[model samples]
Target: MGGSLPRSVDDLPLLPDLVAPQAWSADLVAASDGLFERGVRVLRDGEGGLLVIGDAVMRALAQDPAVGGTPVEFLTGRAGDRVRRATGAAPPSGAAAFDAFLRNQVFTMNAALHVAVRRVVARHLVPRAVLGMAGHAERVLVGVLDEVTRVGGVVDLERDVAGPYVTRFWTDQLGVPAGAALRVQQLVHEMNRMFLFAPTLEDRARVLAATEEYLELVGRTVAMAWERGDNALLGHLARGLDGIDLPGAPPDLGALVAANFFDGFHTVAVAVANAARCLLADAPAAERVRRAPSLVAAAFTEGARLTAPLMLTTRMALGDVEHAGLRIPAGTPITMAWIAANRDPEAYDEPGGYRLDRPPRLGTTFGGGARICPGRGATRMLGEVALRALTATSVQVRLESPQPGWVPGSAIRRHPAIPVVVRRVAAA
Candidate 1:
């Protein structure tokens, strides 16, 4: 491996078949029920990773006053040689590997550069993203529905309406070039599978090549946006605020763009679709949101709690850690099951139910601690705005197929297509 990015052989292993039944199931998280119900708080996976579950461990891992702030390093291994070998750079077994690792690390999650890049980029993205969802939200969503109605009003909900809406916001508000959002999303996702999840070396080689192509494409896009100097997120990073480069040079143009679009595309899109799925599943619930517009955010939050868009995250123990009776050795790879943790019965009255009245900031849908998702506010806003706009119309929202299911990607839970039929309601 040239760079050290793959999490584990298991995380994003090449699928045995193209599509798994679990991916198409009504309940996406159902596959993990047994793991979630294990009597022990921590279970060892075959790959030597630790699986943390239930209310107690989740609390300790996420929010224990004493251990809550413990540093869990991001997953990266000695793939420096791999990157060097793959990219054909002169390298021996010394600093070459480390340097290669850092180079590859820059564009990925849990990078040394992540903090600085996020600090710079969020300052620009957050405000505009909120504004896009606020000011142009109605217009943006109207556009989505119009597209939905155009194709006979029958869609897989996820691929058609929910998926496109995220890119539309990026293009319309974030200054991403028109018609480039889809391609950008495609490239970013290929990278994201490597960045956020684990893939085999063979798979990594294939995707990493595409990810490099993505980086190149985004780099060019960022250059144009930088020259334009628009107030969009891209411009802000290009403007170079927050002393981003200093101490260490700032991330390259493509990494910055990858930071924005890669995660933004599917995470928020799946979340929006999840909200729509939850809303459509219950007429009364959708009606409640329609009646009390303010609760739209709650609907999105609830949907995320049930169907986490990015279900699990890797956290490496900084040192030997003990919480209650469980002892986690230092340097152990701990997989935080946000989905299982969110659904832990101890945390919620009815963990699996789609009720929108839960306490605010209830779960790790957007992560927690130092690594809390910078775009949570924006994600919620996007979902709320999109859902609000859709429900505003008197259209029937239902499952597209007789048996609806989620698409298979353990790293990112999505529906290959959640078919839906939207017909106008008859006037009284």
Candidate 2:
């Protein structure tokens, strides 16, 4: 966990007791401004920790020649050397390995997206005849809805469903044994638990166990593809997993699974829920999206911009850097405040307003540069599917309670539970 700082100087006077005393220091405030000016990827002070802000800097670190094309590692307390080795160095590059990794990643991401879209379309849109697809979309939606209802109200949206869905889809695409898919699902669940839920030492151990199991499966799948001289499979896996260094890490499986989960499920799910909340709060916005299915993506993007799930990203200064006429010394910790940056008055017109048709403003939701999220396209597609389903259905969403709020201490903004009453509309 990291210390908290006020969103801006104006909020400094309201620092709560939970905020780290050091977070209110003058040097940190100056560094925050300097980070905005330099457009550097990372900013740090004397402490060597970092706040990663600028897209330019983020891109540079991702493509840094010094690391052989690896993103700069953000060093944390007592973990500098370990973190450096894990993220600061690049993977062994050979044509064969790199190609395979890339291909595998594409296949996995596409497969995951496919499942997500299908889930939404079948469950929400098809039944309502919103997209006019033939066949029994209603049956499919009913099956899932019935199952969910039977299972009770408590659903682990990320773990019990989305994680398993992606893992199964990915494994099937890669021709891996079906049994191993469960291990992947467990890995995904544990990682989400660790990073996004009640993070604890025991939770971490579960993550490690799941990771080991997944790696064994991935390793076997990779070897089998190679032995069969399957060029396509080899190339995909190589490219997808290329440059990932996991030496001395708790468990390679856990980290990789975690990465995939983060890329695929976490962001998209949160975005979907949050976007729905936004629409429900503003009737005009909801009507705009409902009237035009083509505008779903735009609406989602606007919602994301307004309430960026991630609050901040971190980076450490590798050396002294000058930004906006201020000098930031080597080893400083820099925090890139995404929530603030997305709302910057200079960057966004009517910063607080959510207008779907507005021109795209370059923002850091999926990050930028070499480390920019590779699964961004797929995630967007997933969001589109969810929106399409929700809008197509004639279910009226009424706020049973006050508008939902976000949970703190998370790297991303998340809605714990959105209690809304869904009443099916009478047939027109």
Candidate 3:
């Protein structure tokens, strides 16, 4: 849901070449400040095109009379059809078109993974395991806290804690093959590298190769589950890949598995790292969250809002439409800067402040409308469990460095590596 791009906007290049992760952060802050005081500002992109970055513009686009329908349709199937008709090309099947659409844009695996993981998570075996693992993770993290006092130094949260938790959960609880889980971890690391720095052709090749292999691993696992006649697994798989029509109705299991790996492991890893960074930045907040495990959800939501594991969302205008007095012709690309929307002062109080007590509000983190993230519940569950584990453990964390930065891709926002020191607390 968060991944689709409108046909009109597909070819439009909205992001600058020097798109840094911090770039949007700055832009969002400026936009928020300006919007609060002066109303909406329609800035022009580098190519003499208009770009709307204010909350009112986003709200108007989302709710105005001219644009009131489904917010996501402009970037998905409907928009694709419009583009095909305009270009005089054969209309591709929805599933095939969606697949192709994702390949061209950034971090579309989120949508693919939503389909894939939900299949697995909805399975009796997997969901049970996930819930059980959540409990186990809480215990493990709490145990780690108990041992923190012995080390009495900073620890790398990702390597020492987050990575290990994921590795253990996927391998032991989820029943994924041990080797595959390890490879997934490696793939996650590689993705982090490629996303953060400019990689050479060889490096890109290596990452893609590993990605394919990991997908195959997941495919095998899903197949095994299906062989066991897991109804939930089968149903989830069928619905998630509903748009994809295979020969004799056999699912393109490989593609589905690949999508899962891309969406599941990678984004969660980034979210965990960013959450930890946020905790370190505000020690009091960390302590508060640790004491109240239920606040885990709030912390995760806030982290996602601030860091936005996925950054930019794109849509194409279905027809020539005038929005807020701006002429957005048919087949034009529209880049919805979710980062800007989440930080909009009008929607959020103290737009820049990280407050866990904020009301139950939906942010653009999982997106909005029909294309909203289906795996939202599971993602929140994962964050809650992981945070619970860390907080329960008697682990002491100290930020050893300055604010950990993010690597900005056209779609996903990730931190390269956040180095911190964690030590076990000795028994009293």
Candidate 4:
């Protein structure tokens, strides 16, 4: 098993120094593009790990559970312990429970447990179930666009449309009280800060606090659904848990529900904003989508490929694995640069441009294999509804700036607020 392969990922040639963080934010695609342009498929991540590019390598590693296993504290177990071990300080008060809660999350589970939980969750997000919600998504988006029409002028797409639309959709699905949905959304947002690449001590504390509140709300919502005998998402989860006969303690139903809901909600919100920004940046594409609604799905696919909402997903080498002529030592963390893989020149012709003609299943934006995001179908459906609704209107939408103003974070690609001018146009 040990011939000419490099002993460690660090032995691989490293990319030259990266630009400052602010510069990376200015052009989110530049850093990955630069690395890909230099023919650097593997490089040290500087955190004693490796960053991998190229679509084929990423897809292979992602599929092979023997090689790539989730190692992120946010996804796996003992986040609090890791923080304490790293900083030599006691973690937040709820850190232990929070970590335990995370361990039961679908992304963190392994083998049979992961399969069992995913089986329950995937049934709800399948094409049929997601299609059943299409009318709801369209109605919600149309209502938002109607409001945007009423409040003509400059509009923040993230704030005015994506945020509210996604929140409403999830809240309605989860059966949260109308008066409490906004607060639930706020709690989820706060809980999300813990995902930042290097969250501050304060951020960790806030996440723990927010997790408690979020779980409480979710529990109450699910209980209410059960009381009313409604088929809300949480109620379905509750019923689904009863049939699972996994070894060890029963899974934390509330944590599973909260984690899954937050993942779907947060990613979809960012995807909607990012896709909108991508669509608005290209006039001809938007007009094409406007003329042919069927093209909206392709537009969303192209947009997700270009924007890559979830940029980097990490995994630890479960065993010494050789790939692309280099050996990644066991225990070394591998960061799959999804954003870079999505834009790989070898994989796509003109990878940077947003074009709808790209064939289906072309990118790693939604991930691949076992961990391929189960919410992908829902994300595509909702994004298509949003783009279609925006195009169906007789309003002119123009970006306030050529480049999107991003939410300052190293974790995900998201625009905090996509400001645009929306002026009413005469009906044709």
Return the top candidate by lDDT.
4
lDDT of 4 by residue, 20-94 (tens): 555544554677787667666666765567777777778877887765446436353445644565466766665
Give the alpha carbon lDDT tens digit for every residue of 199-303 in model 1: 345545555565566666656776677677774555555666435554444346555555455567667877888778878777888899888888888888888
Q: Candidate 3, residue 245: CA error in Å?
A: 5.2
Worst 10 residues of 2 by lDDT: 67-76
Write down the RMSD of candidate 4 (Cα, Å): 3.5
Model 3 C-alpha RMSD vs. true structure (Å) is 8.4
Between prediction 2 and prediction 3, the one with superior TM-score is 3
RMSD of each: 7.9, 10.9, 8.4, 3.5
lDDT of each: 0.60, 0.45, 0.53, 0.74
Give the Cα-based TM-score of candidate 2 against the true structure.
0.59
TM-score of the candidate numbered 3? Answer: 0.68
How would you encode candidate 2's per-residue C-alpha lDDT over 127-173 as one tens digit per residue? 23333321222332333334444564444333333334444444543
TM-score of each: 0.77, 0.59, 0.68, 0.88
| Count of clashes, each model | 12, 32, 25, 0
lDDT of 4: 0.74
Best TM-score goes to which candidate?
A: 4
